[model samples]
Target: MYMILKSMKKNKLRNLVIVVQLIFGIVILSNSLANYKYYISTREKAENASSSNVYEVSVENKADIFKVGEARDHQYISGEENQISTVYKIAKESKLVEKIGFEGLGCNSCQYTNEEENEGKFILKSKIKTIGIVEYSKELTEMYNFKMKSGMNFSQYYKSEKAEDVIPMLISPQLSKDNPIGSIVKLPGGGKKYKVIGVLDNSCPLLNELYNMGCLYKPNNGYFCVIGSLLTNKKTHLYIKLKDGVSKAEGKNDFDKKLGEKFETQFFGLDDMAETVTLPAPYAARYILFGIIILVLSSFGIINTVLSTILKRKKEFGTRIAVGATKAQIEKLVIGEFIIFFAFSAFIGLIIAKLISGQQAVWDFSVIGISIGIVFLILVISMIPAYFRMRKMNPVDLVHGR
Candidate 1:
């Protein structure tokens, strides 16, 4: 190791160039891998949810029948409610519907506290705009394949105990990390405290989308919570999951006939509903392609530099061999130097990638493992030409400048 470092120091400019190329390659590769992993995971979850035959049912008031001027009138409100109820009734009566769920906005004035105590001392964690509180049914949990990382699901909470002042809630993984299960958080001004009964899995589609809500306009400042209550209000969106082997067209046809001509209903699959959340396939592919190109170019450059460096130092290796050093020892010294260079470069690259990607970066075991594997692969490939050249050199021939 000491000799390797001494040799590297003797050729500082050459080693510095290698390290810079490696750092550049690693930075781009890490960022690309992180994004690609995120995209694949998100797409997997969306595809899984879509395969469950779930569809979102959206009801809109007919623009022709409801004049724009009567939007706030009591009659308009009643008509809207009636239409939602009629659609709900149709969904309930349809045999194609295996289960139904409703999701709607929660209290706008609700403020969440990170405080653990129930003594009314509240430390505001987030406001209404940054935090999304969704009221949903227990069936929604089953309909969309919601998994719990810890604690109990909404059904378990529903069966346990009922508190008038405390509401049982399931929070997203991001929020759950800060406020784990059994954490008592109050929604001040509403006279209700939210009890964290469940922590949702990271793969939950709803939470995933909610977590990425600020990708367009904001800096990803969003948290999500779900309460086990079905809101039948006009603003509530309905979800229906079909039984196995049932086609969406069948459900749509039945719903269209039952909803009549007064109300308009539209259906959206999970992918369609989450189009804004997941990264596009083409973009992810392009990122990965660019990263691969950089990585390959950097690897080739390093290989050429290593081969050149080895050729220049043939007299040094020959002198070492004449002094009783074996070929294996020489090879080990060369490999060790590159390993150190790659390790330092990778560490620096990871930090830079994290800084650039910000909230979107993923640093899981898979990413780290793959990055390490790629670096080692590059190291081995870069040593190939040098290894062959060194093997063919004879101490006498090298000393004679042959």
Candidate 2:
């Protein structure tokens, strides 16, 4: 052990270079691991957040216009009757449709404020559903867990003894001013003042990212998968939560079989949410790109010191061989030194990788494993040839300073 330590100390630059390489590899691995973990976790949370026993019916009709553009061109089909109410009635009759409720579309009057306006108001303009407070449990809030900064989900909005008098409402925190919810929102038709019962959320950065996403995109977690739902003309983009261990495909299948022509609904999963989940090919490209950057920086010090050590030790090596040291033995000495140094360096590098990955929360265990594996692999490849040369030297000529 003492001899090994001394040998490493004598070659400070070489040891340091190898250590830096290990550190780089570990950092990459840790970050990757954490990122993957976040993705898997968030996706599962999204899937399981709701009861598996529950699903929704999106009425794709003029009365059920979910998108603003659809409503813009739509002329009401049935007169003197509530079209949405009628659709809800048919949907409720479907075998697959279980425990259905309706949330009436809000008027723009209730969506706009004295301070600012909400983009979600577009849906409100299209006509919306009104829900009973108790019925809201599975209706409005059972999707992704948006970190709540204030106010409960609109779960209890319509459930009450004062259902008539309780005009309570929930809006995104931004919709609130220094205190926007308590104030009445101006109605689009004018003269109607809707009471703002509460503000939504203003917590994690993850939530902010989700809020910015296009209607099609839902953040997988608080960090990336944010937009849990979207609305389209004649279609209600329902946010669904499957039971734990249920596949989105399976859930969609169940929905179709059960609903059966009552409504034309499209079921989308994580991949469908975006442009199909990305290829690891791109992930590999990222790894290669970032790895190249890290490796180049690491190689400079490593290459410089290794070459310097080889040059400086030429004489020592020549003498060792001339004194009848076997070629294999001489080679082993050179290779062995590097092997030990690299192992230590790789360990330290791994620690650094983990520390740096703290913020990312990506899982990178494989990266770390590969990195450590590569460190020794590179050492063996790099040092083996050098060892041969040192071993093949003509000691007598070398000693005479050839």
Candidate 3:
């Protein structure tokens, strides 16, 4: 046993390869485990934004449902929607609905009106070219907890005719990082300036973040306003938080279709996977596959190395048998040496895996343990081949190198 240690020390390259292979295997397994945890967490978090027996929908109706909150009289196109509005107004007056809210949607595209300022600078997004309708929903804001990081939320003054209705804005994390917040962004049409308000939850749409970050850009007019027109605001989406006992998942197809017809548009069920994490899943899967492949390759290398060591020391094994070593003793010596090698390899691999994982989203100790366990299994399996090769050796002939 001491001779094995001395031999390993003498053959530094061989030992180094074994250690390296172990480390690689552990790192891959740890990363795979980390990724699995991230996806699971995401699923859980997305589920929380809904109530029990509730579902989420993203509506895109060309008809105007969201009304712009301006410091003046509200106006609507005298169309069939007005008829529905009268009915909804009556329904609300009768307390038939538990709650109601409206959010105005708007976007603006800006061209190189200020090319000198932006020509060389790397803008996170195109300059705003179009601006869409702005709406206010007290209930929507309260429940979503979408507070402005800077400036003020819509107050009573915004509802007054004398008050100059100002457009409150917010942005995404990406845009804010690219362009500092609290800066004024130029609009395409009127060259109106909208100040950065706050960055919303990271889960918020990047487009919304862009607006808050002042990185919003349009190629055409600086401002565009449209409310209750789902077809017009294609870029914007809606979120509905159901009250207790709401059943959008059940026999509400007729109701949903009616709403769809009233809005003159299609509604889509928005799944959580569609909303969060810009990181592509293919990359995660590729990492897992790569780790698995590396682990497999390392297992092959380790098994080969162990078997070669046992085979090379055949003469010593034969001598031990001739000196009254029982078959059990021989097997113990063989198995013990390999078990130690594998255990040592596993220890080193775990350390490497931990360092690489850091404090980010994924790989951990469990991954290392599983990986090492697999290595142990491979080691045992490989012993069978080595056993057959060396089992029939006659001590005398083995010692004489015949």
| C-alpha lDDT score of every prediction, in listed order | 0.68, 0.45, 0.47
Model 1 agreement with the true structure over 56-75: per-residue lDDT tens digits: 77565556455543433333
Candidate 2 or 1, higher TM-score = 1
Best by lDDT: 1
What is the TM-score of candidate 3? 0.50
TM-score versus the correct structure, for each prediction:
0.73, 0.46, 0.50
Candidate 1 colliding pairs: none
The TM-score ranking, best first, is 1, 3, 2
Tens digit per residue, CA lDDT, model 3, 1-402: 764565457658876776677667656665656655555444444444322332223323354454433111243424334533533343244322344444444443334456534633432243353333343344334333333334333332134324232344455444555445545554343434444455545332222322222222321332322112221322233334444554444323423444444432222222433244323345656776676676567666756776777677777766777778765666666566556666787777666666676343445456556666666666677567656655665667755645
Q: Which stretches of candidate 1 lie over 4 Å from their true place?
A: 43-52, 59-100, 108-130, 138-145, 160-166, 172-186, 192-195, 207-224, 230-236, 243-245, 256-265, 271-282, 318-333, 354-361
Writing each residue's lDDT as its tens digit, candidate 2 over 19-115 gives: 7675675466445544545444444444443345434434343235344333222433232123444445444554444344322222222234543
Predictions: Cα RMSD each: 5.7, 10.9, 10.9
Query: Lowest-lDDT window of 10 residues in candidate 3?
Result: 225-234
What TM-score, to 2 decimals, does candidate 1 have?
0.73
